[model samples]
Target: MRTSNYDKFPFVPVAKAEACQTGWAAIGAALRAALPAHATPGQPLVLAVECYPGTALGPLRQALTEALHPALCLVADDLYRAPADLDALVAGPLTDDPVFGRLNGLTVRDFLDPQKMQVAQATLAAATGQLVLVLGTGATLVCPSPTVLVYADLARWEIQLRQRRGDIANLGSDNFAEKASLKYKRAYFVDWRAADRLKKQTLPRADFLLDTNDPAAPKLIAGADLRAALAATVRRPFRVVPFFDPGPWGGQWMREHLDLPDGPPNYAWGFDCVLEENSLLLGFGAARVEIPSLDLVFAHPRELLGEAVHGRFGTEFPIRFDFLDTVGGGNLSLQVHPLTEYAFDKFGLSYTQDESYYMLDAAPGATVYLGLKEGAKLPAMLADLQRAQDDPAAPFLAAEYINEFPAHRHDHFLIPAGTIHCSGAGGMVLEISATPYIFTFKLWDWARLGLDGQPRPIHLAHGAANIQPDRTTAWVQQHLVNQVQEVARGEGWREERTGLHEREFIETRRHWFTGPVPHDTLGGVQVLNLVQGAEAVVESPTGAFEPYVVHYAETFIVPAAVGAYTIRPHGPAVGTECATMKAYVRT
Candidate 1:
């Protein structure tokens, strides 16, 4: 319980097996010794890091630190720890933290580095019979060859992270590492064509190997644990190592190495991407691929399409669930998602409207601009946008452009095509919706960009054409807000028309853990994405979880068309509330 200046971490502040220490380097040293030795030539001891509180390290952090203490035992040469203590960890010690308290019996080496870890990788590659797991950030690689690195930016990270406010002290580098480490994971793999290029210089790439088809895909706890599970599941020896990038190595390299036409590749559409495992994209795009295996993803729509598509497209595309953390916030443009006619007529964009906001957490009183204010004038609204450019920030679109709504926790706002809105600051929102192809307008914005230092672009032409003509501003106020009611338990789900698409969109509503949930995919798949809870679990044949599985704050895609799924909630079991929306799945 000893305390000190570093209140951020080492929360316990316990004297080292030796003496008091300072600095991350010293911490790293203590950590290094705790791990097992390198296996043969390429394999190294693996470890998994559990998160904790106490920014400066103290009681809170120590309370949260996982398995590291036991690993320190394994490094007795450096830690001066008792051998028995190490044994204690092998039995159970990683579960000190409430969120990750279940994994106490894992070994020390298994604490920090897991499968794909350089150490674990080298070791597993050697055993011929056993599998090794390694976990790491992007910086661990020191390559010396010519290899192809595929960097895919999936998940609506930029969109959700936009709500972080000034909490992003480190800008792009620091912020990216934190959020990226938390949700955006990495996976390392060896590509023969890519091997030569990366022989000497290790390049960054996306983790795209986790097969949605793998029965164990949904069972994976998080991106960090993905390797250990994959290794344990696979029977054959896999030379391919999927690495997780917890640092700037992959992001920086991805920006620099990508084969952009003129400028760097612009991360256009939103999709989910993990830096662990063997693959990154749920679909395919500008990223590089190893062989014909991933090529077949396109022909299959049921694999990619979600609740949104089946309701319209008559099919699904091979796709995984998309999770987002809107750290920063902005007013979504005030506009209507045109019916299929407006989509094909106005701008030729495919699906419009159809957006869901699953708010995980937020500061008190922070509001989001949802559809037009109750009973407002459409003529005046259009007049305002036309005149919005009159202000100095005129060109600054996407700002307080849409109708502003005060948003609090569990507040679900459905953005049907034609609804004018914007996500204001002061919240971390989980944005889920149709296949992200229908953002039709951008009228105002104070003009902002990601930590990378760039101003967000606006599409006034596209946005303007989508505004509902007879805007009474009362559509949502009258129908949407009024529809809000106590979640009826036993329904297993809820339904309602959000906007113009009749039944095009239906957000899911939970009365907070009434019973087991149904799992199936009509449009694509029912995505049980984690909007708030950590350790959220869905019982599907391919993916499995511990009894009373934990629903850590991470969104997961429950592939559409599957049989009924039993959804279980963890983490205080929604003691407070749950995100609201009618899940728009195909009938």
Candidate 2:
């Protein structure tokens, strides 16, 4: 099932009524304001309405057409390629093995035929009406020219829900990843990717943006003041929509604490910080709507990421934070991510996951396997991995090759890409790293079956190609483990450097205090976690906005526009201290 945490407090930011007004009433008001004072009957008016898959376009089309009489409603699905051609495209070859298997081949171009689309456009253009409503996926792409371009969007999770509920026209009977009995969820992947790509291509050029995330209370972004809305949004502290997924090595920490969906299989990973697959929720009264976090990067890079950083990385949000929990669960698969150049050549990614594990909590004897033993032979290790892969009964000599160190609360273990590592049982780890995360080349998985009751895919060849031989036990100990050192201090607070891995462009620092910590964004974006104590308030020096309250274990961002702010620890015992982990690009 799809998941999101924007509905919960402590994760949602303060909302301004001028920028975010909730409910279907908001959409109705915006639409009325945007419309012309009078409609000329029999005049040609093009309204290109683009939507994600699983949207009930028929109802929307009917509603709009009735509202504007003398209108012609043209459904794009009626113009799609024949059923046989769609089936062939779904089974066609993909650019690579999808990060999420079976969902790779789904794309906008796959389900469409260029010649037929052009013909449909011409046919629609020739027809006469007061309003020509072109509604469906790729509507803007084929409308030739539209008077008003409407990007009607729904969150991926909501779309998935509708698909499961048999509400989507084509995807109703098709199987998704969870319902796949024999093969992969090929059908769902194709539809999902097609909708996703269409939204990406159309949203930027949309004259009016609409949110159907809550079908009961649709919202609209229509006005000459759209830029101001975006600016107002970027100035506030916010969290990306959080989601959870289950895996073979999954734990119960997130499910137990975050009010996540209790499941047949426990939640293994929580996407607390991610951009490519995450979204930002814009809150209005009793209504929350979201846009992909990439929209902020694309539209207002300078405000969110400062001039120096926006110049260096462009629109890319380089820092990522996620959770790796093995508490009351099994060990993670021993893995290494692709090196920088390797990732670009093979996976088309500009970055790699050069990560660090900041332990939140750990049980007795918890361990983390990092780096290789000093004299470990690469060829012998490769042979053992091959044997394990070829014969499931073969032994995995994990201890001989990997150095397992005892883990503790507040410990930070640096793991640059190409280093073999995994978190063992009984620890809750906050994985802070560079943005690219899906390229993990897993070498071993402890011979465990995945949630789908199948063996997870192994990547020995990729791992061997990318593993760095110099990251030995001695090197890891000297350069990676618990390398906390004092950097600066003030009246009642101090700063310490915790993670500054040479391979990563992002660095992490810990601020511990009993009172206020005077700080500035320093011309760059900062992501922070209140890892200790109950609560804290971050306020601007000018008092231009409300004090942003951050709760324990919750993450929030401070945009560069916010210049300077002070962090005041709250709800801690009189003389006790609290701590926060702040991460940002080195620039």
Candidate 3:
């Protein structure tokens, strides 16, 4: 593979005056200086440090205590209900299922004990002539209106890494030894939902925004500066920081092509534009402060995702672009997503995951399993899947029941909800889909152990309920595979409509150009990936925003506020054919 030129740590420069402070001492000093302005004479000053679920509160409280020498320091965890009681409260949302759980509408206050909160309020009312510090996930519940409020945030990806290391537990429970998958499911269903609700209410009013992703090196920025950075971001094309993880069916493609580190066994998944887990870097002078990308969605949904999309999704980013690599590895497990009504009834999701696989790179003889065979019977196929899961020695015989199609470079396979599909070995796929990504129901694995040495979970019952038996080989071939047609052309550029199927709400288009290609967001956000070519540059047509450069396999977003922009081949690909596949919500 050619030498990788991927920009791993992309950041947008903020004003020099908005410099970020590094280290705990500096952060504490800044907060100390700001305390005088908000403090009342002859009264105790309360500093509330409201944290997201995965933040490391121990070190934070310790560092701040030594720096400010607070007379009373309160931990929110001490005010929460006992572990068993908290679990019982959230058991309805965190279902018994291993991988799937219902999205709950619980807020942070629901997790706190009323009696403890009442006592804490009484204590805060009595403290005088001293500095009082309250910190933790539900710290705001104890001290609602503190003299100074600091919101400590960590990205979901960083939280997952911490969970894998057994460094933290779920929000209200102390299950440090629990399986990482179960912990993730609990956080996804219960903790994140509640935390996000609190974050939406408090982030804008926070006096300071704390970056707690790094344990030893914490960064702090003024809340106004952070808000200004986000406002500046929506006027231009930007890329969120990407993260990669290894899996059982991972491959060597990303490690070799993307210049990834060699420490992991293999790279299986690359999250390019999953805003929920990614981070946005804001550069202040030489320092970079990282915050959750979802903050942008919460702060300015209407400007980032247009009026219609905001009306439909309401602060939730609906599109996701990620990579699935199987080159020089094993095949992905056969899986299907739930239908819209099924998703809402069972999982409390407003929409289902409707996705498409665009083959970024495929070795010769690469194939993808899609749809059922022409003569396949639903009962027989389901029985076979059950046998495979029941008896490890019995193989599912995937090729016999599923239709396998040749996967070539740039081939698009539309996978609306309920369509059984998987990418076989020897292919690199860019999966463009809806944001509800973790609802997949696996039907059959290849009887291999996971990276943790346990058998992968299979959801035969859920898969059976959602599978579309009518999507047979002929139907898939006619309507799903390579459904590309020319839409428009100019002197040096042409655009083609790529298939996402009529059932899907995402519309995709492929633009092949050797010169500048014009694009309009059409009153909604647009996401694009440079599928073919080495490099390209995106610029504003009216020079309203700074030019942005992207490399091959890199995904970027243009907010709805950026009405008109142009992209052209740059650097090494200036004279060669460069292609970008763009996806937008269908109006």
Candidate 4:
């Protein structure tokens, strides 16, 4: 096995920073220093500690109250609508479905009770000569104009971990004992959407950006410094912090290859470039501040995504690169993504997940289930799936109806929306696709239970509505499997166009080289993974940015503003062949 060079906590260095305070003592002192100016003659100084949905409020409230010795501290949870009322308010968006829900147009203000907000405001108004801190998820809604606004940020991945640990609950809900998957579904469809909307509105005006991912250790940076760091990052190639998780079908590849710690049964998913659920770290001297990677997309969409992509998808990062490792494990659930019209009509999604499985490493006899077998009927397959789900003793004979293709290293299988597909066991797949990743409708799960010991949720009705009967063996063989064509070649490198199918908006390119290969973003963002060799260094043609080194299986992003860069073998892979698979939105 190769020595692991995978950087788990990659951080971008901030060029200029006034200060990065660590822990509550330093942060509170800094806030206290800034408080004298905002203090009034009669009313108390109102400090709003606005938080993302999953921030640890106990430590935050305790630490701040101890440090500031506030005359009165109000938690936003106290001002929110009652639990039943809040549930009813979000029930429309968070449907009864266990996994899928409709995207709603609710904002953080909708969760706050106006009468309670007025009461809090009146209390703050009647306060005397001391600090009055307002804290919690919707703290800003209660005190819009505060003496100091500190936006406490937490990454979505950390939030998921907390959810699984039962350390935190969903926004305005006391269902900590509920299943993590159900909590995640609610957060995805309701909590996060509302929190993110508030975050976008409050970040620009925030005086301090708090890194609250860690309960014991908190890092604080000036809001301007955080914004500047994000702006600077767009001009250079960088990576978000990758997080891994185990599943029922997880494998040992990541634990062995990525130098992961000994925990969890196995590593099933590696989120390398899913900005919505990843965190971006910024370096301030010896300290690191963690914030949601989506902050960058929201803060500088045009600069990071270019005019065309930003205009087409708004502030969303349209592409994602992640890993599905099933080596020495079991098969993934048979699934299909919804068609665009079906996605919009049913789930309120503007787009669907059109993805491809690029084999990073495949053991002998590894296979990928793609599309359908010739003469396979949807009704028959659905019936079989329903029967298997109904009675676990009778397994669904998947091979009879699904096309299983032999998978090898570097094999690219395109799966457009409505194409039923899954990665079989014994392969490490680099899944490159559109960013609407959670819209998958699982048709079958091999009649196995989830890690939670419950039957995994199936969407047969949703899947039956979207699966394309025409994507049979013949069509898939001609269009999807390993569709590589030589696009260009240089002295020691060659470029190939890999298929994402004509129906998909994302285009993929593969380059194999023992020498430097030039690349440009073509006025849009690009996501690339080093699929071969040990390591490579990405450099600028005009010294616009410093050289960035990436290890094998590491996915990095080059923003549209970067313009041009070159990748060449570095370190142990100097003379060895190296290959990179890059994906970008087709313009």
Best by lDDT: 3
- Report the Cα lDDT for residue 185, model 4: 95
| Candidates by lDDT, descending order | 3, 4, 2, 1
**Residue lDDT tens for model 1, 292-317:** 11221222334444445644554323
RMSD of each: 18.6, 4.5, 1.1, 1.4
lDDT of 2 at 302: 93
Q: Which ten residues in a row have the lowest lDDT in candidate 4?
A: 14-23
What's the TM for model 2?
0.86
Error of 1 at 108 (Å): 50
Q: Write the per-residue lDDT of candidate 2 for residues 380-406, one digit (tens) a residue.
A: 999999999889899688999999999
Identify the candidate with maximal TM-score. 3
Residue-level lDDT tens digits of model 3 in 110-221: 8899999899888888897678999999888788888999999999999998898999999889999998898899998889999999999899999999999888889999
Candidate 3 structure lDDT: 0.93
> Which lDDT values do the candidates have, in the order given?
0.34, 0.73, 0.93, 0.92
Q: lDDT of model 1 at residue 96?
A: 24
Better of 3 and 4 by TM-score: 3
Candidate 1 local lDDT, residue 398: 33
The deviation in Å at residue 161 for candidate 3 is: 0.9
